[model samples]
Target chain A: MATGWKYRTAEAETAEAIDRRCEPRRPLGLRFALMRIRVETELCQGHGRCYMLAPDLFYADDDGYCHPTGERTVPAELADQARRALMNCPEDAIILTEET
Target chain B: MTDAKKYSLEPPEVARNPHDTYREIRDNAPVAELAGRSQTGAVTLSRHEDVMRAFQTPEVFSSDPGAIEIGNIRPLVPLQIDPPHHRKHRKALDPLFAPKQMSKHEPRVRELIRDLIDKVVDQGHCNFHDDIAEPLPSTIFLELLGLPVSRVDEFLALKDGIIRPPARSMEERQEKVKATGQKIYAALEEVVEARMAQREDDFLSTLIDAEVEGQPLSRDDVVDIGYLFFLAGLDTVSASLECMVAFLAQNPGHRQRLVDEPEVIPHAVEEMLRYESPVASAARITAIDTEVNGCPISAGTRIQVLIGSANTDERAWDGPDEVDFDRESKKHIAFGAGVHRCLGSHLARMELRVALEEWHARVPHYRLADGLELQFSQGIRQIDNLKLVW
Candidate 1:
């Protein structure tokens, strides 16, 4: 257990992140879909680099621990920045997926 | 040679570029010993992996040894306190410095930056350190702590002594450091007491009402914490600014690249912070007997983590000495890591980012002023004066 932690990932979770960029895309909805960004709670140390890199996509809790905004699916125009945010997370907690 | 005799954090050599000295130490004895602090009192760890290991496991490697690094001055709250207690302070204080607040304060920060830049943009030449870098952080820090900006010079002078006392002998330096610490406490006590009566939306007020481990902090606790924030906040940003400006002045192509494409500024700032970390060395101690890479560290022994050296360790970073702004996944220990990471990092980044943004926006070309020596303090990498000309 991470001592003195209010926000954390489960015991079974791993810090290694999965980026869906290299995966084969199935053209179903004509490229307009909500991109699901997941946070592995256990791995997130709340460094807030995601917020710093791309504030439009992430926010911090009262304890200053960062949280992805409720609206995870970003526009195609912001896809690049969203990827940068995922890449810049100090803790490998953020994952980008092109799902419904 | 003995561990203590093998290396020195002193001047003559270190005054030139501590990074070079750190690389030398990290290459051979990665965990170099702190001079005058006994044979086994404290060991300086320079490799990125080793530094991270110690910072992460503060349960074994205690941070309460900041006083030793600060010339045996009184212990700083939160910074010197180990986990659980440290977490409590951070929980209450971290939110105030979050990214949310960065946006809230961006305009004011930009205003401050522009105001400073305006003073010298027309002159075509100015002392970058004093005119711009030094004032920006100090002003923000003072406002956050609710300290009077009118006392900026006073606070800066006190900070200088607190971080790097000006004495040759170790004993004399320690004594002066003690006096400076006492003086700062005496001055801040009155301010804290007044804030206790009528609180404001400032750091001191927040701390005054803040609970650590479900209990309100005592007057002394608040003062100690404030002391740490002032010392930690003021000079570090200034030192970094000097280093960055000095680097840019020498490397016109890098500066021109930023001038051409401002998008690269954030990554460039990260590289700069990693390359020229102002808070180069941080002190820790062993809470219990432990082993670091087979080093048998005993309890109560001081351990100095050479953050500057770790960032330059070739084992961790490719071409560690070279500043590559476009370098992918640049993870430097400039802000340390793990639970005890710097609370003001977000603000520091914003300040540096803003400084670069506004400076480049207006003064696109500048160079180091000729024929003047760039003098920096030994402990904290600070240039008292940095002259720049367009």
Candidate 2:
């Protein structure tokens, strides 16, 4: 069967990232990739899956639309959460990109 | 006549399933125009990406003209109003479906389902929709709205008319649909005025007494909001329940799975909803000139997002047409997307899940009554008289 729902950019490790353990264990010993989370607001249907499912990284608009608040870029420590929100988005409107 | 020529959103038939037509358009003409004089400037987005894009960009594709009910141009609260106003309405209304409310009422909902099933269980046969699916959701919703229990049938008629009116001339059907809407609106208006005089414990009374923008809402605001709830919350859950049951009765393997492993019912419900989306397309008016899938659409154009087709779009799902309860990531736009998404989604999910659990506990072995037919409503895609026997 076709694998899971994450729609990622070319640079991010698509298959390997799904297996990576990023359970928010503080004090990383090694360097982590910088991640950027975005909602192609035009494609977001505001299902609240992204915000409701991943509250730490997302909060809904007053209109219950996109959660475009807080640090637009996430530290390596929070990359797992950003990925969860990426998979959770029903509209597939949420995109995740990692900076080299 | 060709399929396109013969296609009517509301055609008169005993056992018509419009999804077959939806599939035809989705494959050949993903952005097909409405074929009649009545549907004039309307276009349906059969592709999933296009449907998602239209709703996600509400600034360009507004629900103001009407989302659920057509030409309801007067703005039916959050349902028909675009954002800013729509957000405020949702802020006030969305919390009503809080988990606390469901925790308090779900046991009661389960009891209600059992009692209704008990009435027909001994007969060894029953019309499933009328017996349980048709009445359960409406009963719970009306009780929430605090509408009198004695007037269930009356409100049921009004709700059904808005969603699935009898197939007739475009002018005639539109007239009936609007008139039904007016009756609902007038009912809310009367209640809002009365509640203003003296409050009650019902949701409507609370809404009447509530404030937005640090100012009390006008009668129109409360009434229109209530009217939208009446039209939306009334028949949608019931329609979904009916659809779920119809599918279960025919597929013994899936039915047995649910009965054997009750814990999977919630996931099963999501799969059922994805496979059989109760509502089809929701309407949006183009607020500005836009292009969907490269097809240029002018401002004021009516875009009907084919939600049913989008759920089954191969571009999104692994096997879009197959019903896989165990499938990973079952996120479908059955309730819609964006700020104008279905406000009653939480309630609908609870009801569908509870209904499945309670029914299987009692009548786990029921099957479609032999020689009987399953006829789904054209507009809302609901089964009215699904006969089942154990």
Interface RMSD of 2: 5.8
Under CAPRI classification, how is model 2 graded? incorrect
Error of 1 at A92 (Å): 5.7
TM-scores of the models, in the order given:
0.84, 0.84
**Number of the predicted model whose DockQ against the real structure is largest:** 2
Off by over 4 Å in 2: A1-85, A92-100, B1-20, B34-40, B66-73
Q: What CAPRI grade goes to candidate 1?
A: incorrect
Residue-wise C-alpha lDDT for candidate 1, range B101-198, written one tens digit per residue: 76577788899999999999998999887899899999988988899899999999998887777786767877887888787887789899999999
**Candidate number achieving the greatest lDDT relative to the actual structure:** 1
Can you list the residue pairs that collide in candidate 1?
A8-A41, A9-A41, A9-A42, B42-B302
Worst 10 residues of 2 chain B by lDDT: B1-10
The C-alpha lDDT values of all candidates are 0.75, 0.73
lDDT string, candidate 2, B1-390, tens digits:
013544456553522555666677777777767465445557778778888888788899898754344424378887888876776767777667644355468887988898998999889999888889878988888888877767889988888777767756877778888888778777777777787898888888888777887788788888777877887878888888888888888899999988997877877887788888887778888989888766787888777788888888887778777888777655788898776778777678778888899899889999988877778875467787799999
